[model samples]
Target: MIPRAVSKNGYAVLNAEDPLVYKMKELVDGRVVCFSMDENNPTIKRRAERGRVSCVYENGYVTILKGKWKVRVEKASNIPLTYGGRAEFMIQNVLAATLACFVHGISIEDIRVGLTTFNAGTAQTPGRLNFIEVGSCTVLMDYAHNPAGFSGLVNFISKLPNKYRTVVINVPGDRRNDDIREMGEIAGNNFDRIVIRAGHYLRGRDASDIAALIQEGINRTGKEPQVRIIPESRDAIQHAIKYARKGELVVTLADIVPDDISHVQEIRDQILKKQQATEV
Candidate 1:
């Protein structure tokens, strides 16, 4: 779609750090502009030297230094979708969208307004790091079913300040055993507690098969964190929350996002009711 979009005389906003994007840039005749978080990326550096790049973003600031205009926008965290900067991937997404708009002659103020107004909520972007507060615990629910997604979530979770962290995860039956194993290893290394659950879509394997494979992977790492298999995803979530306390986080890599989110909201409501009763 990207290459086809540029073929029709539309400007292409390339991720300069991506080698595939660099190759695509070479094949397109239409005006191609680049954006990058890293100034040192060879493509961005080369384009910036030739004044062909549209925008350069780093940390949370974006600069547009193309065409005879220079503009800078700082505090990308002002974009509500980034969750106060905890969702680093969302920041990059905002940068890319902002750069795309700028290249298409959109006003800076409009782009800024659009970004700051966007929020990641259940209604807007369900199953993508939907944050919920249960009593004193923070729960992050996401549809991260693969190793790459798991790694990114773990990296994000590691930065949050919490006394203990719990993760709800399950291995997809269709995934390679090594991939499933890697997911378990990542959870084991990053979280203090883990709940292995079975999602609605098993992809062919029996109920206990995926859990056992994931557990085997976790055991291979030699870390003895608190881990259990609850089989049902919803029950696993409830189990995690039952033991959660203040200054803790529960990150759920949900397989069934809608069901998981509904269950979490129900759990949150119950927590709120209990707290209200105690206070009253």
Candidate 2:
């Protein structure tokens, strides 16, 4: 019986030896299934020594019972998952969502709605997959600053219809130069043109240094990919948008803050409102 509570600050409280503690002691009072352990039970040591059973005494802790061994259980507040767990959870959730939507006669649009409405925390706003329509061209803003995501995005974009050319605007965080460089190298081979931007350099690092690192990686690939260094992210985006042809695709990969997208959404709303008023 384990007792746990969440504080106002969003932290959890877990304590051992509480009244609600479940499975605290194995073979309590010489019974295989006893309600609680008696303090005077002498068999407790012998049972622990035999390693017959184990228990979880507290909300965030597990206790192991060995022959003639009794010790305090360590509390584990948060159980971190490995890559296997992540893959399992992702597959399970996607399958469940797909099945639910299919059984309910939901369309593709309805799938998006269900994900956004019901699975708020689980479904993140599509980072690189969010297609922004600018005239006849398409632009995408993605958080693909990592090598895996960058490679995946390149492969995905290459398969898209009317993908005449791909312009990659990569902006990596200052903290991860090597990661950004590797990402750039991967992107250089995949995209037609590569534009490197200094992303999040305001956090006490020189933008030029980060750009140089990315350039070094790109040069090492020997692909001679068209590379340009743009310090400002907004300028990089504007430049990419300007160069896009009717059927080309411009992809901006960066570590962007959430508020940046919100601001863009607000601007879009204002524009829509003005257009509506004009029509009326």
Q: Which one wins on TM-score?
A: 1
Candidate 1's residue-wise lDDT over 136-216, tens digit each?
A: 899998888898778867777777788799998886788887888888888888888999988777889886887877888
Candidate 2 TM-score, C-alpha based: 0.50
Residue-level lDDT of model 2, residues 137-197, one tens digit each, is: 6666656656756665666565567655555454544447787678767766776777777
Error of 1 at 150 (Å): 2.5
Candidate-wise lDDT, in order: 0.79, 0.49
Error of 2 at 39 (Å): 49
In candidate 2, position 229 carries an lDDT of: 77
Candidate 1: C-alpha RMSD to true structure equals 2.9
Per-model TM values vs. the true structure: 0.85, 0.50
Candidate 1: 10-residue stretch with minimal lDDT: 65-74
71: Cα error in model 1, Å: 2.3
